[model samples]
Target: MWARRRAARQERLDRVAAEAIAEFEARVSSMLATADESHQALLELRELLARELADINGLLAPGGGMPVEMVRAQLEPGDDALAQMDRISAEFTAVRVQVIGKGAADRETLVPLLEDLGGFVEGMGELADNVFGAAEATTELRVNLQDARKDLAPLRARLQPALRAAEDELAATRGAPGWHVRQVALATLGDRLAALEEGRVWPTPEKTTVDLYQELEHELATLRDEIAQTPS
Candidate 1:
């Protein structure tokens, strides 16, 4: 009877973990898409500015072989506009570069988090296998599994701060088109990952483990759907 109950619980655990994975995957996809769009938008802005500069330079060209100073005189009137455009372009370029760098950093930081979560999920799978494969599962083995879960908790917790920072940075730059969608995706990913970490870390009974896991699964599923619905 206990074995049957354990099998049922394992099924539930697997279901939740699968749901969480689906959600995390979707959010990551959304973030990458946003980064791509932002990059293209920055390129367009640069191209437009370049075209304006070329047009203005042509207009200020020396006519009738006028003196260089005379050409300079012709250009002086619109110099402020050129300067302002230069300044705006520089600022926009900087923001674009920063956003790209942030995206790369976010990916780097998230890799470890994903690995850590993978470990937790793997541990759960192994525990479930052992529980079912054994002729009879022992209390001692269950205790050891609990200890393993605890060990995994601290590593997962360590990632929360980094995850929070990535989310915050992503959110701070949401004024641009498509950026707001990415911010939402990043925030959702952070929250889901944190919940997974918490599910492992919480000092709860084995019986309650499935409940925590299922809750995280539900949260992740919702996040995934929301991300999919988010406009690019």
Candidate 2:
């Protein structure tokens, strides 16, 4: 009877852990997809800007002649494209800082907590296996298992809410208008900048997008390892 009860409890623990892992993976997948889309969008915008610049240079160099002052005049700061680009760029930077800095930092706090949970589950599974396979399940093993379950209960209770909160935050970040708005602004800015700075090479914004994407991907991978390390 005691063995049967212990087995039932162990099943429950396993079920809870499995559910938590599934929820976590789903959330991470959604977040990663959003990040990937954002990175791609930024890359496309950067390329579009480069092409616009090239086009401007081609137009300006009619018969291989240059009109630098005219190009500068065309690229005045007050131009609609530049103004819009500046605004969107500022917004994009602000959003990126929030997402990459605060958002990532907040998620980082969860990684260690998850690792702790995973470790607890593994410890419990080993204890269960040892005790159940023995000639007689010992009182000490039962006590230890009970204590482990007690410790794990609160973590399991906390996991769902914490995961939900993270999911909400990620969704908000993904749905922010600034990301889309910035794309349009970048396209316009690229056209204006190209015309103004014809034949001058400028750095691409894709580097920042790639960096942020990689950072987020690394974090996700670490979290995945933690989840996988947990005993089923």
lDDT accuracy of residue 186 in candidate 1: 62
Residue 12 alpha-carbon offset, candidate 1, angstroms: 1.3
lDDT for model 2, on a 0 to 1 scale?
A: 0.42
Q: 172-206 in candidate 1: lDDT tens per residue?
A: 55454566666666666666555444332333455
Query: Number of the top candidate by TM-score?
Result: 2
**Per-residue lDDT value at 85 in model 1:** 38
Backbone clashes per model, in order? 0, 0
lDDT of each: 0.47, 0.42
TM-score to true structure, per model: 0.29, 0.32
Summarize candidate 2's per-residue lDDT along 1-232 as a digit string, tens digits.
Answer: 9999999999999999777767766654555455445444443443444444444444444322123344435434223333343444454444434443433225575455434334433433443333233312222323432453444344434433544443443344444444344334334433433332342322234532223223333444443344334333
The collision pairs in model 2 are: none
Q: Among all windows of ten consecutive residues in candidate 1, which has the lowest summed lDDT?
A: 59-68
Segments in model 1 whose C-alpha atoms lie over 4 Å from true places: 59-108, 111-232
Q: How accurate is candidate 1 locally (lDDT)?
A: 0.47
